[model samples]
Target: MKTAICYYSRHHGNTLRVIEAMAEAGDAELIDVTARSAVRLEDYDRVGFASGIYGFEFHRAVADFARKYLPQGKPVFLVYTYGGAKGAGAKAVAKIAEERGCPVLGEFGCRGFDTFGPFKLAGGIAKGHPDALDLEDARKFYRSLG
Candidate 1:
């Protein structure tokens, strides 16, 4: 399947690592959501949104990118990485897909090193995460779908 993943992987590039493994598994395209121009989602058979969890959600840019350019009626998926796994990032993206009448294939997330706020004081958390095992799981998740 032709897939495109719109992503915003800042800071430690945790989300990028997972997506890269997914891309390597198939002919998936990576569209940076923070790019200068918007991506046209209709170019692919499947679409995905990915980012690191921030403030209990995905980076605002991802939601904005989807709202601005996501086409209607396409199969969508969600991928995210975060220091703390508890967040609404996937839920929000799934809502967007539902609103556009898109069938969600699945959502996946893995632990990522983080030091955004309070955690910074302690150096970081979830260090060495999204490691080999996580990448293997990510690959498995992608293979489970298209």
Candidate 2:
């Protein structure tokens, strides 16, 4: 089945690394939310919403994309990269998907380098994270979703 990943990867580009790895294995398209509008869900069989945590939430652009477009009855999933595990970007997106009548197939996350403002002062916690190992795991995870 065809799939698409709609996301925003700012600050560290960590989320994109994971999503790109996944896309390589899955027949999925990647849409950078900053560079495009919400995509037509009918073009794909499934959708994945991915992004980095920002201010304890999903990136504003991703949130807006979800709010603006989420196809009805589509299978959806979420992936996020975060500095710490406490944030709820994945949870928030999952809720949005559910509310939109999309069945959530699965969700995944990886620890990523953090460079959001003060987080960069320390040269990024989890430096070099979302590394090759993480990318491989993400690809495996997405493949399983198929």
Candidate 3:
């Protein structure tokens, strides 16, 4: 499959670990959405939108990018990392993709190191997360997709 994963992983880079393992295990393009504003998805047979959850959603830019530009009628999947089960963001973004005619594949998530807002007071949460086991699970998840 010609696939691409567009992601945003700031802070502790916990989310990056998962995708890097996944990318290394599979054949796919990994795009860090935070570093660029525009992306071309035309060549991909499958596309993924990944992010770190913020306030029950993905980074605003990621959500907006999916809502605004994710190609219609394509197969799209989701990946996320969060401090808690707050990625109600996935549902919102999935709905947007579905409305645009993108077929929903599935979703995957794992806890990432979080220090946003109040959590920052404690140094961090889920430190060293998206660790070896998490990365292995992510690799399994990608293999399962086939």
Candidate 4:
């Protein structure tokens, strides 16, 4: 399948690890949301939106992309990485995709090293995360979509 991954990975690039592994496994195209203001979904059969959790939500730019430009009636998936396991960024993305008439194929996420704001005080949790096991899990998740 022709797939495209739209993602935003700022901080320590923990979230980007999963996206990268997924792309490499699937041979999907990768679109960095920071570089591209909006994604044109016409080029791919499936679109995956990936991001790091920010305050229990997907990043503002990613949310904006989903709201303003994600194609209607397409199949989409969500991939999120967070320091803690309690957030709903993946659920939020799935909800947005559904609202846009896109079928949610699946979601894949995991706890990644977090070193932002308050978390910085302790150096970071799960340091060096999005580790080998997480990457393998992500690869499997992407493969399962087929």
Highest TM-score scorer: 1
Q: What is the lDDT of residue 133 in candidate 3?
A: 89
Question: 123, model 2: CA deviation in Å?
Answer: 1.7
Q: What is the TM-score of each candidate against the true structure?
A: 0.95, 0.92, 0.91, 0.92
Q: Residues 50-118, candidate 1, lDDT per residue (tens digit)?
A: 999988888889888888887899999999998975567678778888999999999999999998888
The Cα local distance difference test for each model comes to 0.89, 0.84, 0.83, 0.84
lDDT by residue (118-146, candidate 4, tens digit) is 88899988787888999999999999999
lDDT of 3 by residue, 1-146 (tens): 99998888886777777888888889889888767777778789988888888788878777777776688797998888988666486887788887989888888899888888888999878877888888889998888877
- Give stretches of model 1 more than 4 Å off: none
> Worst lDDT window (10 residues) for model 2?
84-93
Which candidate would rank higher by lDDT, 3 or 4?
4
lDDT for 105 (candidate 3): 83
Pick out the ten consecutive residues of candidate 3 with the lowest summed lDDT: 84-93
